[model samples]
Target chain A: MTDHIHDEHCDHEHEAGINWQLVQGWVQTGILIIMGLYFIDLALPGGQLGNYINVDNFGWLTWVGAAIFLSMGIINAADLLRTRPEEHHHDHSHEHDHEHASAGSLSSWIFLGIATIPLIFGLGVPSKPLSADAISGDLSTNVSTINFGTSQSSIDIPSEQRNILDWIKAFSQSSDLREFEGQAVDVIGFVYKDAQLRGTDDFMVVRFTMSCCVADARPFGLVVDFPTGQEFSQDTWIQVKGHIEIRSIDGIDTPVILADSVEVTSQPEQPYLYF
Target chain B: MEFDLTIFATRFLGIFIEATPFLLLGTLASGLIEAFVNKDDIARMVPHNPVLATIMGGMLGFMFPVCECGVVPVTRRLYKKGLPLSTGIAFLLAAPVMNPVVVASTYAAFGAGPVLYGRYIMTALVAIGVGLIFTVQNRPQRILRPQAIFVPITGGSEAVMPAESERMELLPGIKKALLLAHEEFFEMGRYLIFGSLLAAAMGTLALDKEIETLASNPVNSVFVMQASAFILSVCSTVDAFLALAFANTFTTGSILSFLVFGPMVDIKSTMMFLGVFKRRVVFYLIALPFLLTALLSIAINLNIRL
Candidate 1:
């Protein structure tokens, strides 16, 4: 008799607790939003985010964005389509809350749109490269020929001599560092020695660190055959005293640094190189 | 028309593949917790002390370690079981930011130094702070509704018939977990792709140069980076790369803000929050983290010499 009573009570509770409509509504709405965003992107031609959309550098990302935008829009639209608006039998207590929500949606949309404007504009522009002089630090005066620090170059060099030395030669012509010959300037960086080129005392390399992204990181190695070539290792951070000079390596005139002294200091707490 | 047709078909296929894994993992963790942990468990754990509850909620990220996508469904289940709104909210916030996987990835990206340690400490503090703030102001009962649970059983016509009690056993529970994980992965993955695409497009179109100009003003720069982090949609794993790319472009404060804030809140994460919490609750969760992140970023940048 007790078991029967418990079973009957549980059934009543279960029946009263089910809110199928809300769950179904969520599923429907989610589908609608996802679909809508994608369809709109397709129909609108280039997504019309002029000054808002970019795809030039990282083309792999375009497919990813299209997926997310379309999915959310479709889901929202689906929810609206399936659920017939049910008239709420407003309990006197909840009526105030409903009225507030009705008033708030408009403001919410406006806020969302306004917030997205700068975001759109930021995405639509091309990136500006940090100029060569900025990283090498005003080599226009006091340095004979500035070394190409950790920055990347697009110049074409000979196939046989296709390394940093070759890169420096090609980069030098464009930046016109040859004109700055006979001037002295202070250069800061860590020391590395390339084994391939350095015969007992041949080359010393310097690396620059970029805090977040490495693509823009420039490596400016100063080729100094100073007597103390054996002192530095692969990543030993150091500041060397050197002046830029033109030297012949592999039949090409390359800008090399002749070191006056090499000082090994404690790795500065922040090792990143910045302009 | 030819271009559109090819692009549409390619995009559809890409979305399906990307969303599957995350969804699977999210569902697996969410389902198991749902099946075993109940309201009494939460009520007993909390209510005794808010401090203890906050610690417990924050630490739960280690045990379950659900991604942002799976967090909501698991969180929704907890709400149904009567966990406090603040505790559930805290769990949602902490799980994604400081989970084992995310932590490991962060350590790998920044190295296990102040960047890693600071991120862990700050993320926990921020999550707990937000949770407590909400708890003091609002009642969990008012905002959370009971979540619906769907269970399917086989019958005589169904090729696989099962006893009623056996149907509710742990295997079905595992199946539910897997399913939820897959769905959540797909959802979050889709958003992540969208963000990266938008970021890349902006990179190519013209905004890349504009971002550099904005970096001139220290304060406005922070705001721009935080906003870009959300719009870019890069995953936490690779976001460090994107942040590094802009090293020359933005101020240190802005770069820090972009790295810290992007993982915590984004458009997809916001939508996921809406799916779980009430609109009001979602509003606070979405708005508060972004504001807090922006403020914290500026403070860190201003004070620290580095």
Candidate 2:
């Protein structure tokens, strides 16, 4: 497919003096190199890669992509240096189909522009993880349906050490909410309040768990009951020191955290929890 | 809600980072096929009978193992190397969902139950059904773009041979493959990026919130899921987990439609398809699978339980 371009360029070699084909090749080569460096930067520690994706699942794949891009760029650089314009003319002499050559150059430039859209967004826009505003439909409070490991083993973990996901898993496996009564709870998550919890002294302390990226992000939370729960606005990251109590939420028996304290905290470096 | 640029950028980069490796692998394979594989070999391996050939095409994913993002370039390259028309079409549609990686992921998400089996069975039926439709107008000139067709429509035994000077030894072939891979990468990479941009924009705008309203209606839910699948353009290997998020709220058929149809045709894969097939053929590629999967899923919704 590429041979046609070189063959076409031979026709305009003398008239143009500049090999537009070579310039196009170098542009692509530069784009590949920059793209390679971008992926490598994301894979590094403290990089913003996790803000977008679950790095645990795709961290190594990012490195593989970097290698592929860098290697392809280097190979193209080598090819452009080794092969003279005259050699390309001779190598693809018979493959010239001139009708599409003019159209091909125009379309190739358009494609090159299209290929840079990600780079424009990746560099130009500041990275931010999805927050409560990203919640599209109803918040997932039902713990029974999710397959977040139903071994009844997470309950054994000390209350202070367990995160939102661990608590949800424990809730999923236990037959009764009373089993978690008075369990000391210390977890950090963002506050999410919907219409139902707006008037009451309750709101959801939620964290999104993703098996892949944010496209599949599913929110899981336990209802928090505080006298001033409404004061902690939506999507405010907070550390809740509390104890679990069985309460009837919308007439369904569920575990609700009764908070001793709620302190505002900064978002974690890795915002989304991975299963 | 107003468009959030930050969220759009995050989602765009995430989708691109997750998908690009597969696209690179695809172009690399395309390059290798261009360098090493002979057209005669592809012609020889495919079954002569059209029906068997189409079925074999749907099954080819076990060997190639490309998702929707990677399948287009590989399918185009295979076409260039003299793969039959129906078989190539079938592979293009089925390989994304039929591969082992997707199977394992779907099984992990849904278990060995109706959703898992329904996905594979539905994909095979739709893909092969579309492939068979191509057999009616089996001429390459009718279906493929001019640049995609390499071998003449003559019988396989009379395949055209490359010039002796064009053939290469192992080391040179490897170099040639890399060079071709570089070119193919740029050719196909643009489509992936463009599709990601559209998917990201739609995601940031929260268009899915509008679709969620239609989920309660059984028939509307199937089309709604299909629209979500097309817009989201998530990778097939991990999309099962995404579908799991909707397992409770969505009907069985709609969820199955998302699993089966998402892999075959999405914004990204459709853009890539435009690179290989004629403009009209791309329409059929999208429509054929969409209609077939919808009809079958609705049938399952109305009749079957699981």
Candidate 3:
């Protein structure tokens, strides 16, 4: 009985031993909490907020997830302190080496360092929305591919609400875009240079679209024929007042908005279109 | 490769932030199973008939609803609890995309298009096919590493001390789950970071004018999207939205390939596979899905209405 009790006490001590695993665990917890707080702490939903998630409705889900990490960290920290260090659960082989996995081990440190990189950068770096440069980037090259109609959204309304996304959706569902030709649209997006619409003042007005998060965001838009397309700088937010017309771009009859009026505007609170 | 810092950081955090919740949910579920469910019960529950067990495993996500990032650890916990190799593998592959959340999301993104139905059918086929491949084997001992083997639980509830009685020790049992969850999260999260890094690198650098150029051809388009799917590592919960974005540019079949094959095999989950299976087995696991998804998707791409 005495031997068993002593063994239990030793086990408690071992668990409580301060080591690299416990430290890493606390750090992991901190990383999760900080990432969560970064989103929750925003005063106005900014580009960084959109960088991680798309819908505000499900924003609270992120907080719950971060709280799990925080609580788990506290639990590990509590365990480290409560048990007073006789021998760690994994450190039974030698007279030395105290750790949850292995204290001061090379792999342990490497994993810890790798785990900490994101936390370091995530906190230090300021978040920017995917810019016009995104088009040249790998993921955004196919800017016209994203389809954005929620079946619940009625595109057949008297005035089609073809924000860059709505245009893609209507363009995608129809074999011939004649139905949409001459339809007036009030579309807002950033000016992006398109290879196909090279000259003659044809630049795309695009809004990047996201489903679950921004990593998956893809630029979705239609070519806007502004007489001064060459003058407006790439990535300048602009509102195009126009009517949709089917124009042949690189073979296919694609929708292009003939802008009657163009006005410069600041980027909106929610820059990316969400589903 | 010179990574644009902003692009890389945005994508890295994006994948991590998006996947973290599902991963947490998976670990918590794993903890609950580890704490409450006995090893024998899992063994007993998994049907013995190879085909039935494979189908059952593939369909397990109807109840579990874990994301691809999170399902690995849950499957690992189940594997450690004596779940048949066939069932565990099928569940691991199928649950991420096959669950109702994936279904609703896929439907929402594709609007009942072939991509939606194709995503379901292809995921099931790949999952059940992989599961059945393991059925001929003698309990996969050679494939699994020593660390992954099922070990008898020695501690009481795995979270609390053995001296505590099982009936009255609910909090400690839960504490045990949290403790185990933290440990599991650390173990699995390391791989997740590596996967996300590779994915971010690929997302930032690899996609370019060549992909857009090749996307004009049906065959090349399918291959490009499949490769992109493997590289992107977007969570299954929202990949359909990503695929929907590709709908107009790529064939329905190619978009379907992206939707079906991505969650099944990707950089992030592929890295995690090394933690669970032997090096050679991981290669085979990857190649099988890659080949099958490619062949079936290409076939659909060729035959389906363009």
Using all chains and alpha carbons, the TM-scores for the candidates as numbered come to: 0.49, 0.89, 0.84
Per-chain TM-score of candidate 2, chain B: 0.92
Please give, for residues B263-298, the per-residue lDDT of candidate 3 as tens digits: 888898988877788899888888888788888888
Please give the ranking of all candidate structures by TM-score, highest first, separated by commas.
2, 3, 1
- Which candidate do you rate higher for lDDT, 1 or 2? 2
**Ordered list by DockQ, greatest first:** 2, 3, 1
Task: List ranges where model 3 is wrong by over 4 Å.
Answer: A1-29, A32-36, A42-47, A87-101, A137-154, A157-161, A174-182, A242-254, B110-117, B153-168, B204-221, B245-253, B298-306
User: What C-alpha lDDT, on a 0 to 100 scale, does residue B100 get in candidate 1?
Assistant: 74
TM-score of 1: 0.49
Q: lDDT tens string, model 1, B95-135?
A: 77667777765655556665566566666777787877876
Instruction: Give fnat for candidate 3.
Output: 0.60
Candidate 2, residue A94: Cα displacement in angstroms equals 9.5
- lDDT of model 1, residue B292: 79
Per-residue lDDT tens digits of candidate 1, residues A69-160? 34434443443345343421111112123221221244423433432332333333332222211232211111223333233442543322
Give a tens-digit lDDT track for model 2, residues A136-249. 655535566555421245878998789998998887767887888999999999998865565688988888777777666667787888888878888999999999998775
Quick one: best DockQ, which candidate? Answer: 2
DockQ metric, candidate 1 = 0.03
Alpha-carbon deviation at B275 in model 1, angstroms: 0.8
